[model samples]
Target chain A: MDNFDKIAVIGGGSWATAIVKMLCENNSTIGWYMRSIYAVEHIKRNKHNPNYLSSAELHPEQLDLSNDINEIVGKYDVLIFAVPSAFLNSELEKLNESLENKVIFSAIKGIVPETGLIVGEHFHQLYNISYENIGVIAGPCHAEEVAMERLSYLTIACQDEKKAKALSKKIKGRYIKTKVSDDIFGTEYSAMLKNIYAIAAGIAHGLGYGDNFQSVLMSNAIREMKRYIKKVHRMKRNINNSAYLGDLLVTGYSVFSRNRMFGNMIGKGYTVKSAMLEMNMVAEGYYATKSAYKINQENGAKTPIIDAVYEVLYEKKEAKDVFEKLTNMLD
Target chain B: MDNFDKIAVIGGGSWATAIVKMLCENNSTIGWYMRSIYAVEHIKRNKHNPNYLSSAELHPEQLDLSNDINEIVGKYDVLIFAVPSAFLNSELEKLNESLENKVIFSAIKGIVPETGLIVGEHFHQLYNISYENIGVIAGPCHAEEVAMERLSYLTIACQDEKKAKALSKKIKGRYIKTKVSDDIFGTEYSAMLKNIYAIAAGIAHGLGYGDNFQSVLMSNAIREMKRYIKKVHRMKRNINNSAYLGDLLVTGYSVFSRNRMFGNMIGKGYTVKSAMLEMNMVAEGYYATKSAYKINQENGAKTPIIDAVYEVLYEKKEAKDVFEKLTNMLD
Candidate 1:
């Protein structure tokens, strides 16, 4: 129906910038809300995000960059929240009133700290919006690839099939392909859970485990993901789906994966603090591990991989010791 | 119920050797039938298969190797058909009389060359046995890894869940984990279809398409796989399960996969003949493409990936041209 005239993207991160660039290709005006004046000024001045996607240039003409959250949210019909999970709540609180009629979509993939609610749920609660008004762009997709004009696919998950389809039509293109799914909770949960497994995969790699072990860890992670997602959401998730298993495999093993790289460093005897500091990027898995561990404990869900990751990251267990513990759990 | 004692593995391939080795680990004598005197002599003398798994050292004390099919089949209680798809019928024909009351499992993955029947279906017709007697091992696994004693998982499919579980317990070990599924045809079809997609993935890689496009191809391949499997078998297969989608993803993308590696060579400017000659191994996709194309034509199923792979392999279409055609087809 071409309902969304202007798409509002929140955050100046790699993923948000990539989405805004893709949406701009459709000849639609994009409102990008960045809290940092430096990010907004850089996009306005250099017409590109030098920090994350330095190679691909962004067109400043197509973008309406703003530091004021209210000004940005008020300009678009569809609002895309691409901020980190930790910042989602505060960002939504700033746009609470403006979010009423707009179709809000969360591109963030993590559970709210301590609350264990998904980003979409957090948005719905703070904004006082119906679930139908909320959609999640969950996937086996990365913004870095999209910036390179690489083809990627994502699942547009919403309980309302009509809204999901509508959003799918808006974002679907050559560089980005979108599939419609009814299981919003399952999709969001999968996106969140995979980060935890990616960290675990890194830890395994760091422990001198080879590709064979990494593949096995991924296989087990998918099973554990299915179990945890099913227990919490009461929805049937295909552990094999692109959003769940596919994402896990790629992120768990790919050289481009920061979480895996971070984990590998930890596996190679780097302290968690040093690894994170050296990465100079937040490996979502670091935060996701603690969040997922808490959720698993509260829900009484059995997630051996998540437990192992939490132990390695927080409980001060050695990466090799964690690998030995996980290997023993396999039989 | 530990139903069988002596296990007959009917093939001299990597998978057959690996299964024989696993059975040997449990202190069970394995009868392996091989048609080649060279292979038989090699297995007998060096106690290793230099063809499929060069790294694995076979223990001669635990295995009985023979070129005589009758001698191998008559003595064993459980028979595993690990021969190539092209050889399954003739091999089964030789062991038909001995197949009665024996647990016959297919480690092969492809439809029959001319008949277009799944190996299990051919066995059902040849021996006049119920489908219950036929078992198909579908996987997110590889023989090379299994031979290396790497942990792997597989799905044992049959119409009878009780029999499936019983068989699973018999074959499963610390390294080889097995699960049971009632959707025998769907699982079988998915296993064969994955080889075709692996070829497509290889072609994509050869075309210099990045991981983004390859991931999309894989995602699309899973969708196409689910559609074709469901259309032909009419069973409710969880497309996201490890048996279906998981197997496809691993085999389609992994460096350890022969089919993918073979396809990769073709994608990287090697001819099919050259790729085959270079590897000095059978790329199951090369054979599977023809059979799957024939089956789709006969069953009125839509398998664009299979059709495209068939066209590229048999029609002699340039790898880049096939990729261009596939991308356009998606549009």
Candidate 2:
């Protein structure tokens, strides 16, 4: 608790609420921040998140709540950012406090739009945060499951081995299991890429492809992921690790994945804008497809799944035609 | 088509019938054997299988139907065994002719119970057949989907490269795509191993594990598979190949997979005997698990999935308790 005592979670989504719930199991007190003063007041009075994970109660005495980003950033030694990447830039814009020494953990699973880099890379280049101080929280674990207290596993990745193990202990509990790893680049990229694959899975499902096809699609997708990440980072780690393959499987197969949901709507013949309007939350894969497509153009990895999703979501190509072509490309 | 002209399918199940159906599309004449005299008559009279994939029509003129194993084996240059592995030995016992010169292709996905060998191995060891003459048909393709004429892919694996390619062309059609591989050992073992994993997937689903857990289970299952296969038969094969990973995914996730269905029942509190009584056919994984569990005792691969499933199915351990322990073993 000595090292973990001053941790804070940013953003007000379901994942942020879930992260707070996990941290509270080990540490008695921590900080939380949200932009909405009204939501802050609502949680303080009601003892639960008003919008997400409402069943997970928070102790008012344990939580240091604030509307100003700088107030929480100034106080906490460790910052866990859980905001959607699309909005991450604006949140960091309000941070007057320097994060050079503070350890930062990212729970966000997208590339920052302006930089087209993962949250950790964005912070390292833009905020002058060292990679050694950057950490990532990855999962096959879903927030709804954590709220239900079902068994879940999390991978805490950092360039600093000691920091990773220390953070892993703070998050592990009765239903939550944690593993520590030093491959932060692989974990973060896998997290980002899985969302795109999930969108691919959802699109296939929406187009009425059975579970048989879904499984084959996933098999090919993981292989493609191995190829893509190898070209980008070229690490010695197994992609089958929970941080990579397990995370990909969950996002691709789980009903909780919003990227899959967005892809499903597109496969069902909704235009991208209509699908986004229907779902109030942002789907990171929609933004990720563009960034990944641009990145792959330079790197030149053979990614049929990503290309199909990009064609459907960005180029306004027919989902049926793209997926039909995709089926031939796979297996 | 000319080389595959003397080909015969040596089983009466849905998969055997599907094979015969695919072969007939390319060859002008093919042989089929069903041990059931009743099923043979039913097919001849009704133009389809009486018990399995009943919708797939067969022309009596195109098929050389027989019940005697010796007649089929003696006349056919290539013998494709599609019978359930549990009954394969007794069926083979009826054959008086040797398989020394015949090309043996195994579509069966279980170890011969008495011999404790796969169908190809059983033929190679007992009938003095060569590995060069042994072949395996691997699939993410389900027979029911084939009956529905859905597009599907198959991998024909043989030690002899030319034989593998020749068989691939015979099976390739408008609805089916075929790829040839020379890794006969890797493909056959993976084909057998996938059924066991499918049962594990089913058991988890039956015990109320969600897709997140299933994906994790499957991801771990694949790695475990890679580990186990490497121990028994070291090779340069990618487990992600359609023959390995694709086949495993379909069996583990597909609704049509009897192995998964058998596992689901076990997880849903049915005893082994009760689950077997409820289902009419053999679940190959039930037998594969026992054989694999025995083999791994010497191989010493750390297979928590196989061990947990064996405990639940054979050792009579409680599914809930076994799976709870399995959660700790996974990530």
Candidate 3:
């Protein structure tokens, strides 16, 4: 706590608010940076983020809230970014202050849209941050469940096992459990790939596929995920770990996943533009599908599920037909 | 179709009816053995099983329905057994016809209660049937879904790959897809173990755990399953195959699973006797938990979920307290 006490959280999403809620159990003061001053003002006045997880109360005395990214960056040594990957670059663009010395953790379970690199790699290559300084937070946890105070587990991954363990200590609480890992890349990639699979799950459900097919799809999916991640980053990590398989299962099966909801609409015959307009949230997998489809073209894992999802979501193929082909490919 | 064409299906349950439905597509005549002449007469008249899968239409012209087990066994060269494992020994006791020359397939997903051996092993060791003659039918396929004709996958596992492929051909049809594997032991154990896990999944859900915990539980369950099966069988089977993981997923998540429903009732504070009394069907996991718990005690695999379920259902531990302890053991 002595060296890593000054922790700052970025983004104004439900997940970010949930993280702040968890950190507040141990940290007396947390630096919070949000681009929207209106959301910040609402939280300051209401003692909760009015937009997300409104039930989670906050003590203003424990928060160092600011709109300025550089101001927050200059103030904290440990910075946790929780923004959507699509908006990550824009937020970092506002940071004129150097991240060379700050210990960075990504609670963002995605690749940066601008660079098609995971948050850790993006920070290392573009911001010149050391690999040891970057860490990841992977969860089978949902922000809504965390707001409800349901028990959830998280895996903290970093090249520096000490940094991962140090941050994991602050996040463990009555309702939260944590594990530490050195396989940062594996955890991060698994987090990203799961969103794509969840979309496939939603599409299958909307297409009237039953639990029997869904399970086969999931079982095949974990294998596909293992193949893809291992191809990209060869590590001695178990794909069955909660960080990989658990995240995939929760996201794919949860009713709360926006990616699945988006895919459900697509399966229900909503076009790409209409589905996006209907839901006020980003699906993440929509962009991820394109990036991963392209990425896997090089890695060349036998990714039938990802290909089927890409064909349906992006290539304007019929969901029914695509999935019909997928069924034959699955078992 | 050479020597295995005269097929007999033994059992009158939904799954048996489903397998019959699949076989009827290829076999113009199938030897059907049921203990109840009433149900046979009912199917003959109604063109569907009166007790289960009542929606699945049957062609009595294609079925050689019989009340006597030996009569059907004597006529068929290949036998598919779908009886509940608890009733298996008694059913086999009625068979005077030798099964030594017949290629036997087990659709039973529980162990033989008397000998505590899986159906395949019991036939191999006790009945003088060669391991080469014993096969397993595993599924992420549910009969309810099969009745609805939704696409489902089945895995046929046998020591002889040729027999597995031959049976897979009979089972594969317009709606059903099949995979063949030489993993009779792995598939059989996986089929038995998944029921126990499904009950655990149900108990967790009934105890108010959310999707987050469910996924973590599933991820952990699969790893535990791999450990347990690998220890007992010591086979080179991929735990991610449709036969193992897919079957577990469907059983755990499907609303049609009686095991999950039974566990749900128990978790909701019903006494085991009361829960059993309420359901008309057999929840196979209830018996499976006891068998698997004892099996693992000797195998020495770390089976926390199986142990927790056994304590809650068999030892009468409170679901809440048991699950609280289970949460700490997971992830």
RMSD of each: 4.0, 2.2, 1.5
- Candidate 2 per-residue lDDT, tens place, B1-331, comes to 1266689999999899999999988999889988988998888888999999999988878888988888888899998999988999899888888776788899988899998887788888888888889999988788887887777888999988889988998999977878788887778788888888888888888988876677688888889999999988897988887788888877877766889999999989998999999997678888888989998999999999999989988899998999999999998
> Could you tally the backbone clashes for each prediction?
2, 0, 0
Instruction: Give one digit per residue, the lDDT tens place, for model 2 in A1-331.
Output: 1265689999998899999888888888879999989889988899899988999887777788888999999999899999989999999988788786899999999999988999999999888888889999999878888887777789999989888898898899987888898888888888999999999999988988766577678888889999888878887988887789889877887776899999899889999999999998669998899998888999999999999999998899999999999988987
Candidate achieving the largest DockQ: 3
Chain B, candidate 3: TM-score:
0.97
CAPRI-style docking class of model 3 based on DockQ: high
lDDT of 3 at A276: 90
What does candidate 3's lDDT look like per residue over B1-331, in tens digits? 2376888999999899999999999988999999899999999998989999999999999999999999999999999999889988999899888886899999999988888888898998899999888999999789999999888899998888888888888889988999999888889888999999899988888888878888899899999999998888886778998889899888887766889898888888888899989997668888888889998889899999999999998898899999999998998
Q: Rate the local accuracy (lDDT) of all candidates.
A: 0.77, 0.87, 0.90
Q: Can you rank all candidates by TM-score, best first?
A: 3, 2, 1
TM-score of 1: 0.85
Candidate 3's C-alpha runs over 4 A off are B280-282
